[model samples]
Target: MSVTIEILSGLGAKGPAAIVVEAQGKRLLLDAGGALHPDDTITWANNLDVDAVLISHDHIDHIGGVAELAENVPLYCTPLVAKALPHNRPWHPLPERGTLEVEGITVTTGQAGHSLGGVWLHLAVGNGVLYSGDACFESSVFPFDTPPKAAIALLDASYGSYDQPQAYCVQAISERLDQPLAFPVPETGRALEMALWLAKEADRRQLTLAIDPVIRDNLAALLALPATLRRPGLDHSIRSLLARQNACPPTLQLMCDRSDTPEQWPDHHLLHTGYLTPDRRAELAAGQISWQRWNVHLRASHLVALADQLGATQVVPLFTPFSDNALSAWHGLLGERLCTAQRLYAPSRLVTRSSLGSFACPQ
Candidate 1:
């Protein structure tokens, strides 16, 4: 069973998100999303013959249009992601994991530790291809494992170029900690991670640590993640932590710089949102607060590590529009393993690079 993937749209296009996977005459679409591109083509709207749809996770980009897709296709994903689906019309069918047949092809999915219900896909017949839909190999939250024995691998290169840590960032923050300083970050996910790392380091070093009441709850959420975050695409750990909380305030704003008792927290982080207007930016900048923008996405160094781990006969980058620099960087790291991309869906020369000695696909 051979599968052909069509990258319909990505990264703030009119069509919010959707990828068509054709396998042995069967269609397995992933993420029927909102207007991904600026101009929504609705190319997927008319295709109803999809045997199954695998939702990578429940972020808006991946699950926003699930309800709309459910109107036409049979969907399959994690229960957590299924529950996370948002729809207004009512009585929409929820799709979860289960094996099935489509046009003589076998389809299966595995955990992809991006968010709740995140997953990677697999389809096989003669030469198999593994569809890695946004995955992180070296993550503090979770690391997804790769499948065995696949001819071609369609990987998620979202952070594929990530290969190094923010040494400067850590140094900057550490320097400020000596004095009363604020490390303002995103109110949601990555902020929690930073807080946790800080909290742990502070405890070990016996340094005074503090969380703004604004982000006390976010700190708590981060603390909770350690227990429940067994895999990707599900926040059951967070949900369980919330259940254990005897009492929690409605909000938290870590405005001060004093690390104290755990009870001093509320929830969430204090982010410097770009969505804020120019006036807001001015006000934030004027305010005596330290702002930091740190994300959990893999760095260029991490991508190099990823290539080393796979050690495949050939290495390729997909899902990235431009990656020559990243590829070159990986070339330095992987040496023989690193190779150019195999144009799965392009008009140009299909083969990008080959090793000193490699076998051509048996045609």
Candidate 2:
């Protein structure tokens, strides 16, 4: 049986999130997200007759396009994600470390560790294919298990080649606690981790902490889930670390759910916790706007390490804008085994169906 991974979307920060996995004539849609640009069209997933849709997380970018999918298609996602989405149709809750057979293909899921309930899929087909759906290797608040092994790995390399310790970011934020700090993070992914961290850091420095209502809602949702599914005592821990709302200025602010700015405040600094476009970077630089490169996405170094650990023969980088340095690093590590997505799906590619099942990519 031949297996093909069609990158429907999410190759860059500006694009929506979606991936279509086809093997043994079974079609699986990964995430149904809308395009960020008005001119850019959403993926053609709406046109495909997919057997099932696997949502990696509950992020709007990953779920927005779900509205366009055909009716009655089985949607598989975590309970947290299920609760977040509009549910006119029935959605199946994905089980932790569980395997589901879709059209005779074995699909298994593992914790992605990016958001509250993100997942990485292990598709047992011709050659096992591992899809890392916006993964984070380390987080203080979110709990994620070690990724399982697979023959071919599709990874999230959002940071390109940049690699640094998590403490580097924490200390960067800590040094800025002297002034008001604003962190714009997605409600699900790194919001809770950064919020809890900022709360503790603020308390340690005796600064006030104020959370946006949207962030508060996200935290509350995680807390509402079963404790066994969440980081132990995460709820109590964040509450304990939070500064009393009535406290003074020079506060730590977790911003989300709204784009409007506050009328007035102290000398505040802005730090974006996700992807930074070149235009935005230029604006921040010209304006001297305080911004930090804090994110939960995996770097190239992390991807290489994970692939090595998994003993993967072919590594396909996903969610990238084609970073030369990162691709060079991948080439150095995997050598000829490193396969580009284009080459993997090229019509004239020499990689036969049988070779994919073993652990080889077309040269």
* C-alpha lDDT score of every prediction, in listed order: 0.47, 0.68
lDDT of 1 by residue, 171-244 (tens): 55555444433344434334444545565455555555555443456435434443334334336443443343
lDDT of 1 at 159: 47
Candidate 2: tens digits of C-alpha lDDT, residues 143-240? 55555566677788767666786778877867777777677677887888887877777667877877776666677777766675566667677566
Location of the lowest summed lDDT over 10 successive residues in candidate 1: 354-363
Model 1 Cα shift for residue 241 (angstroms): 7.4
Q: In model 1, which regions exceed 4 Å deviation?
A: 11-17, 33-49, 67-70, 88-104, 166-195, 198-295, 301-363
User: Candidate 1 local accuracy as lDDT?
Assistant: 0.47
Which residue runs does candidate 2 get wrong by more than 4 Å?
12-14, 37-40, 87-89, 226-228, 231-235, 239-250, 260-267, 277-279, 323-326, 343-363
The estimated TM-scores of all candidates read: 0.58, 0.84
